[model samples]
Target: MKATTTSAIVLAGGLGTRLRSAVPDLPKPMAPVAGRPFLAHLLDRWIDQGITHFVLSVGYRHEVIRAYFGGTYGGATLDYAVEATPQGTGGGLLLAAQHLPADAPFLLLNGDTFFDVPLSQLTELAASQQTDWCFALFRTSEPGRYMGMEIAQDSRITNLRTGMEQPERLANGGVYIVHPRSLSGLAAQPDTPLSLENDLFPRLLAAGQRWFGLECPGAFIDIGIPQDFHRAASVLPVHTAQRTEDALHH
Candidate 1:
């Protein structure tokens, strides 16, 4: 699929309870990484890949994000989906389903995590897999704090971790390529907040559905906590260099 045809859904509706000390007044997406909001850097990279449409899932202090980004940032068309009540990752994506194209696959990323994977490569892999979903995987030196996935020798995601099992294996980098058909039954239960990691992924695995994972080699950063936020800000140049290299290759 062409980059212009693939829409992006940014899951920005999190409450950011962990990083509230540094960014108490704004949503996580609007929190400053270096001098500008983190979303600015994310959008810049996405635009390099030819993505033009964006659906931002906003919740707490959502007005802050809206006021700053408005309808469009740079050349990307932006749309907002407000979650009156807090929802998990899967729920937030479901809420923004209306803004996505039914025939084309879309990219989804967490507002708090940053990685340097080539979006076009991921898109091509998703199209080739002919599967429901594909996620970007990061092999962290310390996978003790994140969800893990066990992939078969063929690179198919055979299993996913939950509860105590998550910290024991490779971590899940918060990026995904999702087909609209993969989310067919998500909205059936509206009241409960279902997690894409905890609830949805395992179910997909049980049903014998194939999900692909792309192991990224570029720098990965998670700005959900104060320490991580500081580390990411300090390493902004490194991230920029990796992104630039990836763009040139693409």
Candidate 2:
């Protein structure tokens, strides 16, 4: 059977401390890429993928994001979950996830990064595995920067941590398809700062929840640091154009 999830929750709340010099006074997702906000580009791709609804977890100068894209964009409905203080990625996702339907899975993406993944294909993989959640993984040399996860022979994720050693490590691509139940056991409350990489995911592993990591590759870049932020302007245009072309051909 096809998965019953139709929406995605985007983590758009972080304070871009590293990119503050180039993109001051704006949320990281609002950082301009090729004359448009980076989030807009992601949204465009999601819409092309047939996603019609989105929940944006917003904080740290969130009004800027709200002002730019109101309740809707490109025929996709938009909703917002505001955090009064820094609640980290896990807390923000848990809060935003409350807006999702209780029985279905919803997609999640990091606001400051882009990974050209086939959303529908990933969802299909999740259904075939019968897991509560699935994450996209990319082979990378710098596992220290992005969290590293070990993929088992059965395609289940076994371990995750920062600073994982050299070769054979797959970087977390910051994209997910999660059944709401997968997040229901989160150990933190809304007011607390919680990290998915540092806290929530480890607990899920300890609990033996069925989750898989998919080795996905394509135009991937994050503007979390100054160097990557500077590089995104050049890299994303190539990616965005290719995504558009693919959408048309499909």
Candidate 3:
């Protein structure tokens, strides 16, 4: 059976320190790409994939995001989980995840990065493997820039490392299909920064949770730095056009 995961959580609360020069007053996800907030493009793609509800974890000038998007965009319901202070990625995710339905798998995304992995494929893999978390992965020739993942032949994720200098390895695409039960024991501690990649995921792996990786050959981009932020202005519009064409042809 095809997996039924339509709810998504976006981690949009990052401080955007690296992109501060370019987007001095906005949250990283609110940085404009192709004349619209980067989150808009992210939401558009998920909406195309049939996601009907989204919970955005917003901090660091979050009002800009809230004021612009409001309660709905492109026909999908938008909800916000505001952080009064800086909570790290994992904390923000846990905060936003509370808005999701209690019993279904949901999608997770990083607001600054865009990896167009098909949601259906990720959910299908999660169902077939009965995985607690199904990671969408992409091959990157440049290492040390993204988290490296080691996968067994059966698709089980055997290892995770912050930096892998090896070439053409699978890296986390910043997209995920997660079972709600996976977050069972994880709670955000006050004033403590929790990193999803640096802390929670490694601990979960050590505990032998069912984590699997599915490599996706999709267009990927991260608008975290100045150069890439400018590059997104060109790349994203072309990607949108291409995706629309692909849908029409299909």
RMSD of 2: 4.3
lDDT of each: 0.77, 0.82, 0.87
Alpha-carbon runs more than 4 Å astray in model 1: 1-5, 163-169, 188-190, 237-250
lDDT of 2 by residue, 1-250 (tens): 5545569999999998888998887899989887678898888777778888999999999998887788877778899999988889998988898888988878999998888888877898888887787999888887478888878888888887678878667889999988788877563365679987887888788888888988887788888887887778777634335333223322
1 versus 3: better TM-score goes to = 3
Leading candidate by lDDT = 3
The most accurate candidate by TM-score is 3
Q: What are the root-mean-square deviations of the candidates from the true structure over C-alphas?
A: 5.0, 4.3, 4.4
- Report the backbone clash tally of model 3: 0
What TM-score does structure 1 among the candidates reach? 0.88
Q: Could you tell me every candidate's TM-score relative to the true structure?
A: 0.88, 0.91, 0.93
Task: Kindly report which residue stretches of model 3 are placed more than 4 angstroms away from their true locations once superposed.
Answer: 237-250
lDDT of the structure predicted as candidate 3: 0.87
Better of 1 and 3 by lDDT: 3
